[model samples]
Target: MNDDLKQAAGISFIEQTTLDRATIRTAYRPDYGAAPAYKSYPDAAVLELPRAAWQLSEARIINLLQRRRSLRTFAETPVSLHQLAFVLWASQGVTALAGNHLLRTAPSAGALYPIETYVSLQRVEGQASGIYHFDTRAFQLRLVVEGDQGSGLAAAFLGQQFLGQASFCLVWTAVSRRSMGKYGDRGVRYLLLDAGHICQNALLAAEAVNLGSCPAAAFYDRELNDLLGIDGYEEIALYGAAFGAKQETTTPLAGR
Candidate 1:
């Protein structure tokens, strides 16, 4: 185990990337002119979502927060298109456009949304199981790979079969250059933070819709990136979550 955690492992790499006053004083240089163009797939077939068709329950924020739990098991029932749309909206739906940037449901550093949203569906209402990309610009779903992908993704996650049991799983990938071009090394740090903000919104949204929710992070990076059809360097998987009808096995808040 000690040999496996050699000095040149991930911790060392992350430490090297940490931005500090001294490091910035000597090594910081940013080119503000660079901005990432919007991402899309023109060739993929699109499905416009029925946004706001399903209302988030009247549950208050405090209750939702209190009830939020990482549900590990889910029912076999399919997730509705409306529920999926709301979850996406809660995570990355564009609320407005400012100049060239699109402001979303979650806050982003410098309005640079380097994160992209994708879905792996095992079962969904009015949609076939497949890999789909959420195009925030048009509020549409682009079919990336047709047919079920949960099993393959489950394999990449080292046999975390529970992921394959959900109605669908949302995967977030980061385009680091989008943030780094403006803030230099600091922007790289923002990429991970942005992902956290987005996924948290998703988890809360799941609670609002009465769906089971669980965040997923353990996965083989290269294999997952390959499944998403993105090069491991330019775009990489950062976070994910499984959501479906509640087959929950959780206790109430402890000693409130």
Candidate 2:
């Protein structure tokens, strides 16, 4: 193992740190002021996604789970707008609101839901190639930056050319203050685990739609954050996944 891995392993043991009691008390305290459950881009143009008449295929949840795999190669065909919406919904769609809290498809610590989903569209039908923020509350996509970002995304991902070729890539960012405010330093762990839940949902959702997905944990952090126009300190990129139609003969996951 490398020095970084060795150092990380040394500190991996669990122990009660100085902030344990204080952080736990703060997290469980009632009536604590919290950040809004959703992030909004008010100035951007919102393209309301198609909610009626979804074209999703019939696939057993067990079958989808069994077939899930990291798909790096994608066909040149474009993903439909409906399919795009379905994947986004599965990943971070809001199901209901209870008082001040929003319940999502994935569970979150304290329902703080710190993860934000962004997309770099390369080949989605009825959508321009650009960066968009998934507005979970509104069920719309707020276009952030206009124009093609395929090559830039690939470069930011350390020359993972397949990322640029995929129909769209999901970029997940963690808003530190959302979790950290409650759990203190321990919130960092929650942030990562929450991201995993979101990504797994994306993967299974994509598979159900005959689309393939590949999760990527390695990338140039500063570069990706800059590309997504997020300050690395406050909201930073944590994970990413590329999705597109699977090549012929291999059969797209949706058709199975």
Candidate 3:
């Protein structure tokens, strides 16, 4: 192999190599305490989401798994608030509570749940076009920025035009300290894995409801974080996905 290729492959192995337990415990611990598991916006206008009916879909789990694909094209149909609620629930809905701790639809390392979900609402019924934070604990949307941001969001996502055509986009961010307290540098890895789990739930949920979704990682980091009004240091954007009704040509995946 060429020298450059060998160097690139070596970097991958270096990153994935496990650290000794003693070094992990002593070298990586932060001086400060861990961040809170959940975030809240007190002054932002709150819109209570409808309770997600734990309704069963006719689509078998195996079929949903087999047919799941990255779909970028969206139809002109506006997504109803009910459908939006289902997608959010499937992604991060709190399923149970123990004392003060909460369990969600997606699994997280140490149950830290470092990832937070934000939505850029473009064409949802009965909801204004704006940016909103998913208040997972309360199952509500806290308005962050009001008014249509679809065009700007598309720009932030590296000019992916399909984003502007979708009804809404799910933006996932990681609050590093949530996982760092326990896992230290390794927490960053867990944060990414947790994001994948959350986005996968969203994709499957969208497909079950006859909606189309496409997970995207290509974007300008600083620009997207700035647009979401999150500080890039403590919290940063990690993953994103656009979802909406599929065009007529897109066959329904639930039955297959």
For model 2, the local distance difference test gives 0.83
How much is 220 displaced in model 2, in angstroms? 0.6
The segments of candidate 3 whose C-alpha lies over 4 angstroms from its true place after superposition are 1-59, 250-256
Candidate 3: residue 56 Cα off by (Å)? 14
Clashing pairs in 3: none
Q: Rank the candidates by lDDT, best first.
A: 2, 3, 1
Instruction: List the candidates' TM-scores in order.
Output: 0.74, 0.75, 0.74
Provide C-alpha RMSD values for all models, in order: 16.0, 16.4, 16.5
What is the per-residue lDDT of model 1 for residues 1-256, given as tens digits with 9 covering 90 to 100?
2332224233234434433333445875565786668888889999999744545563377667889999878887888999998999999989988999889999999998999999997888878899999999899989999999999988777668988888999999987668766786677678889999999999999988999899988776667888999865556687899999996457689899
Our model 2 lands, by Cα RMSD against the true structure, at: 16.4
Model 2 ranges off by over 4 Å: 1-59, 250-256
Candidate 1: residue pairs that collide: none
Model 2, residue 183: C-alpha shift (Å): 0.8
